[model samples]
Target: MLPWLLCALLGVLVLALLGKVCALTRSMEEICDQLADRLAGDTNNLLTLSTRDPHARRLAARLNVQLRLLRQQRRRYLNGDRELKEAVTNLSHDLRTPLTALCGYLDLLDRQETSPAVARYLDQIRSRAEAMKALTEEIFRYSLLAARESWDWEDVTLNQVLEESLLAHYGALTQRGITPQLDLTEVPVHRRLDRKAVSRVLANLLSNALKYSAGDLRVALTPAGEITFSNTAPGLTPVMVGRLFDRFYTVETGRTATGLGLAIAKLLTEAMGGTIQADYRGETLTLTLRFPPAEEKAAPRAVPGGGGVE
Candidate 1:
């Protein structure tokens, strides 16, 4: 009888140990799920395990320490980002007033009649002043746009916007002696986009082409919402092409390159749930932009009538 009782007590002890381990395993799984949820969402709560198992408790303690540190670092980064944005906004505002006054004076000077030498000097002054004014405006606009988290959206027909932008730069293109080859789809390619933002993006691309094109400029729009702007850019290196959309990055070959054009285009494109990319190959640089069709809109079924202008 004694031997039987001892054997029964040993079995009971083993079962208790197994139960404890299973409890620990379940507790650990719960802790992992809670941690994953905290990471995915905005929660930063510390992990707490109900099990008194040493291993489970230790893991929970370690995770809680790391979580607290991560939250602190994230908070610090957000604060710094906000501060920098505010500074840029203030600086843009400060520069605009003086820039306006300077442009006013330059206009006044341009109106005054003078000798040929004086006239030449005034013209140079006017050109430089105009460039400065343009740069100032772009900077101010960039700061404002960067600070904005959302955009005012609308239904924008890209073909019409493209035509308008091209026409606006027609004089510049003509002066440069470059006839743009345009292949536009006849069927209206409609997108739910910010008209002003898309217009600015097109204008920037056209302006960049005017500055860099070595005789050839090609622009095409497809029914799939893809827009391509291709031009011969002999001056750009592979490295430069890679950083084409980086903010305030200018290269020696680009005259009057503020480096903000592509950056602004990228910012606005991303904000509108679109993408813009640059490709460089054998003296040619191509910029491609696309906007994903809106979810609620049906796929466009209109037949495409494509045309090209030399």
Candidate 2:
């Protein structure tokens, strides 16, 4: 009788240990779910487990501490980003007045007659001044976009927009002695987009091609809303192509580039729920842009990592 009683006691102890283990496992599973949701920007709930086991309690506590640290770091990053945007805005605004004055002086000088040597010097000064002015304007526009300016969205015909943009740059293309190969869809592809923003994107791409094209530029737009711009770039490497959209990043081949054109295009494209990517192979560089159709434009746009043209 005594042996049987001791066996029963041991059996009860083992059952209790198994029960505790099961409870801890359930608690851990819930904690993991919550952590995953939080990391995906879907939830803000803190980890709370209802397990009485001391080991499980300690694990929960450690995870909560780490979550708190993560939240603190994210808060700091947001604050710093806001401050930087404000600084850029103010600096860009301040530089504009003097830039305008410089351009005005150059224009005045251009209107007056001078010797060929003096004319050459004045032309060089004018070119640099114009470049500076353009860069300043881009910086200002970038600041506004960073500050989240409101968009005037409408139903835009992308085909017409692209055609107009190409026509506008026809003179530039002719000057570069490169004939653009265009394969545009006959059917008009439409998207709920900002007309100005889309035009800017196309203009930036064409301007980049004009700057870096070896001798040819190929552009194609499909009925599915995929736009492709490809050109032969002589000295661009794969690494350079990867960082082409990064702000203020310029390559040795782009001597006069401000490096913000493609960056702005990326910002506007993403804001309008679109995707853009760049690829480089065997001295050829290509950029692809896609916009969701009007029916699907309401979905959230995922920000892509860096990619673009020179």
Each prediction's whole-model lDDT (CA): 0.81, 0.84
TM-score of each: 0.75, 0.80
Residue-level lDDT tens digits of model 1 in 63-162: 8898888888878877887787678768878887887888788778778888999989878877787777677777777777766554556788988999
Alpha-carbon shift of residue 271 in model 2 (angstroms)? 3.3
What candidate 1 gets wrong by more than 4 Å, as runs, is 1-37, 46-57, 106-128, 186-188, 294-310
lDDT of 2: 0.84
Candidate 1: minimum summed lDDT over ten consecutive residues — where? 301-310
lDDT of 2 by residue, 141-197 (tens): 777766754566788988999999999999999999999999999999988877887
Weakest 10 consecutive residues of candidate 2 by summed lDDT? 301-310
Count of backbone clashes, every candidate in sequence:
0, 0
Candidate 1, TM-score vs. the true structure?
A: 0.75
